[model samples]
Target: MLRFLEVFAKGSQIHVPVGSPLIRKIPIFVDEHDVTAGAMKLIKVLRPAWDTSDVKTKLFTDGTTNKLVGCYVEDSPEDVVLVRVYGHKTELIVDRDNELKSFQVLHANGCAPRLYCTFLNGICYEFMQGDALGTQDVRDPSLRRLIAGEMARIHAIHAHNGCIPKPNLWIKMRRYFSLVATEFTDQASNVRIQQEVPSKAVLEQEMAWMKEHLSTLGSPVVLCHNDLLCKNIIHNEKDGHVRFIDYEYSSYNYQAFDIGNHFNEFAGMAELDYGLYPSREMQMDWLRVYLQAYKLFSQKGEEVSARELETLYVQVNKFALASHFFWGFWALIQAKYSTIDFDFLGYAVLRFNRYFETKPAAMALQIPQ
Candidate 1:
């Protein structure tokens, strides 16, 4: 006995019944005017149309100018529409265009949800309906193997008409880390920490590690979903398949980085505030399956060996170190900006220590010349 509402902005008002199932069948619509009014207007319209008394909406951003707001209705089985608003009009348009392009690519490959519509300021797609696979489930051998295989399948599709964007992994990481370090350093003394700033010495050490291992990382970059986390993965029980959502971080990078990131998420070591005992045996099993699947689709797979896989594992550990350090610094700054609580800094510190504990073994895995 539940109904859905479709609220869209056009030159004139387009209305459908408040309790119509047709609303659930169509995508939410927005135009240039919708972005101008911000997300509030949309929420206001939805509130009455959906006849919800306990609906709440909130916005979240990573200190970036572009913000996305999620509108959730309590105790409702209706679709959720995420409204993205950007500080700068130009930036908003550009982001929407990129989203449309990315959605088209996935749709063409028959791998993702269909894009329902778009506008000058934003785009909308079918909401993925399923249960999210949590960190523990993603770490399972069978599930990890399946995930690895699907990722390879996604990467195998050549960029349409052989067009590819420049790989920006290293550059983006450098900028992100720089911002984090500067922000944390400004607030170090306030937290009663003797070492107020992230040690520049540590950053230099990680940079040196990356420079030293560049040659062995991988060759001919492949498409990478750089931000593979547990929440981004959805499990469709009906079809028994795993689907990855959120491509805002998609780019071309060394395939090994993707593998390492997935492992890091499964290990649940990113939070740094908590300890995890991810099974090494399970880790190895996932790696073997991933590499095998990669080989099935990659030309370079023919040259890959077990030793190479071990080496990649070590290198990924280095990447993990750098990533952990970057996020720790980020958390520190976030605390200073009042964007987060003091616990953020503590979590960063704990993660850094854990990475340090594992660094020696990771380094020892480096193959001899």
Candidate 2:
């Protein structure tokens, strides 16, 4: 299940292969070396645990990103301790804000994983013990509302950054598109990824079309969980609430993009079955709960209308194209550089294909004046 090959450190820069050995080490030598070294460091310095000798750890292999995850089994299993090895950042395509800073903000707001300590190669945090909601759990009306409330709390978090007025849709995507082009150019030099993906011209055309249409949506900019696939939302049966994890892609963006991106996730995870996309009724039901919760948490009582919801409904579906294009082109970059073994090029094609198939109908939606 290891996604990376070799990770070598050279000076301040870490040339981590598709998978880093340090990450793989924790799982392989869970108790003897990996857990003992991590546990002793935590007890003497970070956070003292029940007993280091009794501690046990295991690798979590569900992630596509090559971060190594080791869960500690200790005195109280409910108090989960997770050690996460960092992935290489050779490609800083997006204008990423401080990942650690954003994470602390969410944790302080009581909505993210609780941090324990930060080490050179990895970090440790208290894992929220819960079931990672699947596509079916995501569709349930009550659980959907709970997840909506969590997103509202996240969007309301005020994290100041150098990008004065958060980057607009076009500005952000244009930069990422440029990076994708560079990746394509780089991958073309190698024979493995030479398969025909969407050309630069086609992406530009699609971008132009999206910019023209999305301009009319006029959604307010907010702090968003740029990535909200089902796995990120964990439902804790003990407390009957959902807690969100993974803030690496968190940013200030159109509310529509966040909501649309999440709704798009209803389509199967890992399997790439577009047939699982949600129905209009299901999405509208979700939006009503989302907007209501968002307003409630922000201490605003503005009445949301069925008509207003209708407009947002049209726009979120329209905005969903950005999610597909964003990750689709992103996969091209990963195809060239990622240590993960997944078919990055094939994934890109699926995303772009969804974009084209959905664009015409989405662009044609009628919003009442």
For lDDT, the strongest prediction is 2
TM-score for each candidate, following the candidate numbering: 0.67, 0.82
Candidate 1 C-alpha error for residue 78, in Å: 6.7
Residues 1-369, model 1: lDDT tens digits:
122221111111112213322212223444433443444455554444654445566454332323455565766644666665433333311233334445556556655665544433444445566776776788666677778777877666565334443444555556556655543454545553346334756665765676466435543466666667677777777777777876655655666667666666664533432234455666567666666777777665544577866765666665665555545554544445442224656666665675677677666666434
User: What is the clash count for each candidate, in the order shown?
Assistant: 1, 4
Candidate 2 — worst ten consecutive residues by lDDT sum? Answer: 6-15
- Looking at model 1, residue 219 earns an lDDT score of 39
Q: Which regions of candidate 2 are displaced past 4 Å?
A: 1-44, 48-51, 90-97, 161-165, 168-171, 183-187, 190-194
- Per-candidate local distance difference test: 0.55, 0.69
Clashes of 1: 1
